[model samples]
Target: MEHSMFCYQCEQAMGGKGCTKYGVCGKSPEISNLQDLIIYQLKGIACYAKPLLEKGEHIDKEIVKFVENALFTTLTNVNFDLDFHLEMLKESQQVKETLRNKAPHGNYPEAATYNLSATKEEMIRDAVIAGVMYEVDLDPDIRSLRSTVLYGLKGISAYGHQARYIGHHSDQVDQFYFIALEAINNNNLTLEELIQMAMRAGDMSVEVMSVLDEANTTRYENPSPQKVNVNIKKGPFIIVSGHDLRDLELLLQQTEGKGINIYTHGEMLPAHGYPGLRKYKHLIGNFGSAWQNQQQEFDGIPGCILMTTNCLMKPRDTYKDRLYVTNVVGWDGIKKIELKEDNTKDFTEIIDKAIELGGFEKNEKEKEILVGFGHHETLSHADTIIKAVKDGKIRHFFVIGGCDGAKPGRNYFTEFAEKVPDDCVILTLACGKYRFNKLEFGTVAGLPRLLDIGQCNDAYSAVRIATALADAFETDVNSLPLTIVLSWYEQKAVADLLALLSLGIKGMYLGPTLPAFISPNVLQYLVDTFDIKPISTADDDLRNSLQQAN
Candidate 1:
């Protein structure tokens, strides 16, 4: 028997289990199954690529890039274009064949040797059964562990994709794509071995994030604390959303002095702190809140919107005509900007649209928020932080950030951030910060009580800050008087959690809900080993965090 589609890879899985007919992210079962087919082929490609790389054979860089792009595309809310998905499915099969012929022959799993059916109709049927639920009879715990590693890789691949976009490449990080991808298809692996692989994926998460962090800083300069304007300036304008700093930089350059004001939206809000980007006088303030609010936030805005990466919503008709996507982001009807043969984008179309629209006719009331507290920027004032902690002025550090969704319990994060004590410092990143970043938390010891740590992938910066603080105090991260309260929406947050867990950092709080793929036993394993808690009421969780744990 074949199923329509089954995906529990996100926080909002239908009924907190799986999306059977349609994805909550607006992915139809056809596209959903096709994405699984692509992922299935990615594993098959990895079987060859992994062994060949281990044997010191060269693999084409495109295969690696394709894998990363594939994982990112399948990430919730990134791609819903049926045709583009079909193209990716075909490419995956091609890549698998290319890799299969290059590898030395050996015993391999069904995934490694699986062949595409002769007809498109047969292929779709096979893909229907090749989804996340393919190994239906596998142990529930193994399935959970395997999905964790797979989702973590998807998260790592998002970073790897971004890292490579900015000329950063890591052989080990690239190799792990194969190592972990191939492992997921092997049902014979024990739970312990799967855990080890999960940790390795975490280690790779940290590495790829470091690669991206270096790539971003080297290209855009290290971020410094700056008050970014949050109101609209009356002029022709364009909004850049998503996590690609490179896209924002290019858009900044293109829109400069053209009488078009560029506004950062969603995750792109932190670009205002980069000296290179901030130097552009016309790079206006942010326009909206988180990605989840886009349909309402961008309603009939008289400007162009460029979605450069993930976290995109299905565009509404009111603004879809003005919506443009580049690279791997896609929706069926929106215009797309592709890189020229030289790997550079010509945003002339988007710029022209901004001019034609003659944006907001009048200026809105001005507002500002502080941003740009990445690892280096935050660590620069380490003396202040350490001294504050030592003197007991800054009582506790709460890391409250992750992806923001339209889910109801999200108010807990808002309330949590709002209720955090005056003496505590809140370090945050991602659109999840939007829930509380607008509120005034004031300054503590010359540092803003709320420290903005850039995009979701900037979890590396958060990790670095934690590690440096631990070293400064001569203790492990868990030993520090720090509490991590996170809200996860997608695979990237999964990778971030894996990174933290791999470093042996425990006693963390995770919400708005647990991922549906984690079975009760697997969740218990995580709970017992890592002490990971599903978030309770903000007040109770905060009270418990303050009164109880070490």
Candidate 2:
């Protein structure tokens, strides 16, 4: 086989088709194939584990955790470490063997019985056959549904992994995961069955997101609306980025009074609103914009950088030495902070690096961004919101938030938010808000027009807010004056989209581009059934949405 690859698991897939030579996210062919092998090995493990789980047998905690993190590791821009991908593959096979040993004898498929004793070279070569293009005989629509469920499962794994760190567990979500993983290998399932499976995955994603929400609020009090400073303080400081709140908490505990300040970047901006985390005074504020601008914003920064989850770009040479990763996030030639024997990650290395770099010289800007308008906060204003609608003080509610990236045309989100009428309130979340978050949207119904509802996983909070509004108005969510315009990039957004559709909500304008994996038939199914749409201009979508609401 020629040394090549194909990956289309993201919104910016090359030409919106697939990446054949290398990933546009900076993943090399070697890393890509190794990730494929891990997925194949995981399928083998699931083949065995699902059956064992069915019989109510014991599966080790580590095995379950591995399955989740390995899926997360394969997400675009999350892990590009060649060695780490190989290591994950090795462990996945060990997990497969362990589960296989405990299984009752039965005729299992090749995925369940494949040998990993082949040389590394052979394993990489095998990935071409095992990767996304597998089951060449499968119907294109069926393939799209399968990819939908599979990719949504990746999102579930990401949230599930983070929730566990805060000591939350959900057997139902885990069971669904095992079933979905095993089912994806079955090519005989029809499109209807796959659609049902996809819906179930969406429902399961809700449960998983709920688990994470509970875990976060349980560990750190539910967020309240507060302003997060974006300017840097003069001192030895570290910029912690990505989506892992628990990791941020642990780092906060370790760095107390160490003469080092901590500033959040990207999705971590919401951390400053959590009561438990915000209590730390040295945990200063956010440092920059969304994940996509890191290469430029992070270039040659004096402070050390710690990435806890996804949204990693290929590092520029100037900042590589100052960068460190924790959890499942990985990149080649970068340092990592690993767990000790007691399962606690000592962030001493990054802390020391921040000290050595001498941190920021002074405050760069006086700007502060608002965050923490979670379900708890938004619901607190429920009576006011309902009254505003009744008095005709509020018109429509526009939900324009999701994952953000460096793709062209993402400016649509920024443009749409700007054009939202003053009578309507806007709800936003995730890193996507960086597009217009800095712009003042003023007030609606005595509340901030732009409500920063929290992180990507906090879509559950947005759902809660919407559902509560519908209940107050004596209608369902679809009947409420809500228009969802989303900007999606990767798998977390995939799960969020599924979760919304599972609730029977419709008319979500999605852009800057549609998923490459969704076949024409599957896309039509969504359009016909859910009234889903690809976004046009902000002016057109806004006009259409308002007209529909009337």
Return the number of clashes found in candidate 2.
0
**Segments in model 1 whose C-alpha atoms lie over 4 Å from true places:** 1-3, 118-120
Q: Write the per-residue lDDT of candidate 1 for residues 1-550, one digit (tens) a residue.
A: 3448899999888988999988888888877888888888888888888889888987788888888899899888899897788778788888999998888889977777988775556667989557777766878888899899999998998888888888998988988988899888886788999989999999999898889999989988999988888888898999999988888888888877899998899999988879878999988799889999999989999999999888888888999989999989999988999988887899998898889998999988889999999999999999999999999888899999999899788999999999999999999999999998889999999889999999988888889999999999999898888899999999999999999898898999999989998889988989999999999898899998887643
Model 1 residue pairs with clashes = none
Question: Which consecutive 10 residues in model 1 have the weakest lDDT in total?
Answer: 115-124
lDDT of 2 at 455: 91
Can you give the TM-score per candidate against the true fold?
0.98, 0.98
Local accuracy of candidate 2 as per-residue lDDT tens digits, 278-381? 99988888888999899999899898999999999999999999999988998888998886777688888888888899987876767877888999999998
330: Cα error in model 2, Å: 0.7
